[model samples]
Target: MPARRRQQGPRRLEEFAFINLIKRRFGRVPRRVAMGIGDDAAVVRGPSTRDWVVTTDLLAEDVHFSLDTTSFDDLGYKAAAANLSDIAAMGGSPTYLLIALAIPTTLSQSDLSRLYQGLHRACRPHHVALIGGDTSSSRAGLFLTITLIGEIARGRAVLRSGARPGDLLYVSGTLGESQAGLMLLGKALTRGIRRGLAPADRARLIGRHRRPTPRVALGEALASRRLATAMIDLSDGLSGDLAHLCEESRVGALLDRSALPLSPALRRFAALAGSSAESLALQGGEDYELLFTLSPRHEAAVQRLGRQLRVPVTNIGRMMPARFGMKERDRHGSLKDLAVTSYRHFT
Candidate 1:
């Protein structure tokens, strides 16, 4: 019989090279992890005075994003930011991260390098450590998954089930800009048109879509102060996420349409695109803003916290009994059923 050929191959070499690239890029190991990338398994310190907050998110090509309108770095940064926003919603401090990627041959190593660099840029502020992960080639488009580990003082982590009736609902930062950006990009980038908007406006809207800021500090502040009754991050649009929070708490919400935060760029874009900013703010997804509920009494304290954090906080509505169902007050002083157009996975 002929001897079996050796398993050594160029594929193995390419994977090793990628590993080395990651090692060189993220070589600095945080004290929390005794071992990080370049190991069979990572060793992380156990929580002592705090509880761990864990979250995982999967981003698939063409579904979660379209490579035609997105860059590799934007993809990585958004993936990390999404996970961070999850931790933020729970009022936890991000510490460690693990990434699993199913890359396609179309993406080059330099593309991946930029992707990792974007991830690092987003996580460095939180001092999150890249512990370990798995990598494999995919026959289809790229797939990226991130598992983030965070810590919160024991029993201090906020949940989406603590909201009570009459509690005020709040959100940090403006909304709808992301959806506006996506619409503009899809229409303009795909067709090579950038007319009717200033360069700054275009950049602002696009930036909101490509990279979102996680309200970690505000979340921590709200949690540590015991202010927020229940909280959630607006990844799936305000109406949708609020619905999720209301469902979990067995309560309902009444939103003030006029109170919905709309960025200047979004307002301008809406005018140019002949669309309503209010609709985008209500139905737009991937804002990554924190939507939280707190008692009416704590409204003042929350305002102070927002100022201290320098984050724009708006009281958009209040919670109601489940029997009331979800509703919103229109601009003409009328109430209507809240329409949730949030992004759904299966649909």
Candidate 2:
């Protein structure tokens, strides 16, 4: 007798079939499978000589982006970039990715191909392969979930911990540009509805919103060279992400407002938006730059590395005694308690 089809809902059978196939092919149970289908990426053992690094990120329509505002190619690129940044945070080299996409049946074949084209663009530079994936139709908007696997030398993978008192806090690249770009795009989109904007400006702001760069090479360089003591990615804004690094290290920090890098365009955008550059620098998210801590001894080396990589490394602050409090020093040298926060899922 043939087995009856399970009526557990669409794709449930497919999901089970996939899981069973993996178990059957791999034979031995997955060790260090820190994660699997349900939550995020599946984490398995790294090479005997290395520590494993794993991360996952989800991209959804409307919440994360809008098709009306972004190109499908850029959307795919940014989605992969986001996950690659996570692996970069651990100072690891991305190896492979498993993609799971849910899209509406209405999507055309060309649209799907364009999305994959974006994914390929982002993955190729990092030498990341799309080894496997699953696809399904959804009644709602498009969704993409990527699981990234990376590897680092044994006991050398950087983590949020390991920061100590007096270590310097640094960030690669300027802040607020992404947010400024966002604001600009939003305005342009609204204006485009009425009068539209110049082709150049529209293209610039739209590009920023659609595609973002991930500092993977810089992260690996910092790790392999032992430049940063602790590190994390700036996906959630500088203030909030800095707090994460400090919290993990059981330390606090003092950010210098004047030291932050702001682009001229971002400055104009912030001004138009009735916000300050400092505010945007502190709270703007999705920068995808590296926010890290390093000992004073490595400062020179870090600078040299930055020059080699052609990326700026700004020393914005230093780790402080937790009891001293997290504060920001203004241009006048006035110290005020800094309320560290960032964009959250629920918020």
Candidate 3:
């Protein structure tokens, strides 16, 4: 579920930050540990044979979000939600969170409280605890970081390399809506003109862009039922994200363009932006939905999961032999090569 974070040259970090990064990276985990650095989090052995899932995420001012289109409350909410999504992708239950922030001189005390308030709002429902974190002054805009600790049953954490040739690719909820929402928040001149939209529609689009929900419950359900062979969160676009999974599994895939799950909001927004819905759904990042693959035999079970969770799940394609290559088939029955169209943060 971890997205590819684009890094600049060498990064200068605080002493503790440096230690955490280096230790977590090069330090060897004990025999009891389940995983390290490769999966959603560093899963270690917990009490009573439970597995501990730990992950950290960052949200920089201009790099991840801008104040122009986002509020402090949503910013705090989204930062926590991003880390929560990582736990969800791992089929773990989020239990504790540590928030670190680099505050700017431009913000007031009241504003800072509102930010924490938003974080609390997100954690209350999931029963996640706010442990502690460090605070620092920033010369630039706000920089936020979150470290989430979660738990799952031992040996139950799903990975992205289990996908096989006959496994069917499935995605939870709709795609492209988040990107379409971001487009609406961009420049008015660049976004183009559209009319006859209701207030609710505008709110829906903007909300999707600002705040997104993590599929935690559904993730646990999928893992508990042994429904998914491989699972990953859609932080990057489906195009590049799926390629990462395929590469890890040593397989190829075929995406059915006609079966892509898109929303009415996406169609309407694409028409206004003079772009196609499929392109947005394929390349748009930050949707935060679950994309996993399962065997064809589980088709009936997947349908049941969809209904039980009240989450719309779509079978977009199937895994193929590596020699066949990763490609997409259009509704017109045309086969085309698929490209890694995901956004690179550094670029």
The Cα error of candidate 2 at residue 302, in Å, is 0.3
270-316, model 3: which lDDT tens digit per residue? 77667899998999887889999998988899889889889999999
Flag regions of model 3 displaced more than 4 Å: 1-46, 188-196, 344-347
Candidate 3: clashing pairs of residues = none
In candidate 2, list every pair of residues with a backbone clash: none
How well does candidate 2 score on lDDT at residue 192? Answer: 33
What stretches of model 1 exceed 4 Å from their correct place? 1-9, 188-194, 344-347
Could you give candidate 1's per-residue lDDT for residues 165-235 as a string of tens digits? 99999999999888877877775433333587788999998899889999999998999899999999998
Query: Going through the candidates in order, what is the number of backbone clashes in each?
Result: 0, 0, 0
Better of 1 and 3 by TM-score: 1
lDDT of 2 by residue, 255-319 (tens): 89999988665665555556798898898888888999999999999989989989999999999
Per-prediction TM-score to the true structure, in the order listed: 0.94, 0.82, 0.84
The best-first sequence of candidates by TM-score reads 1, 3, 2
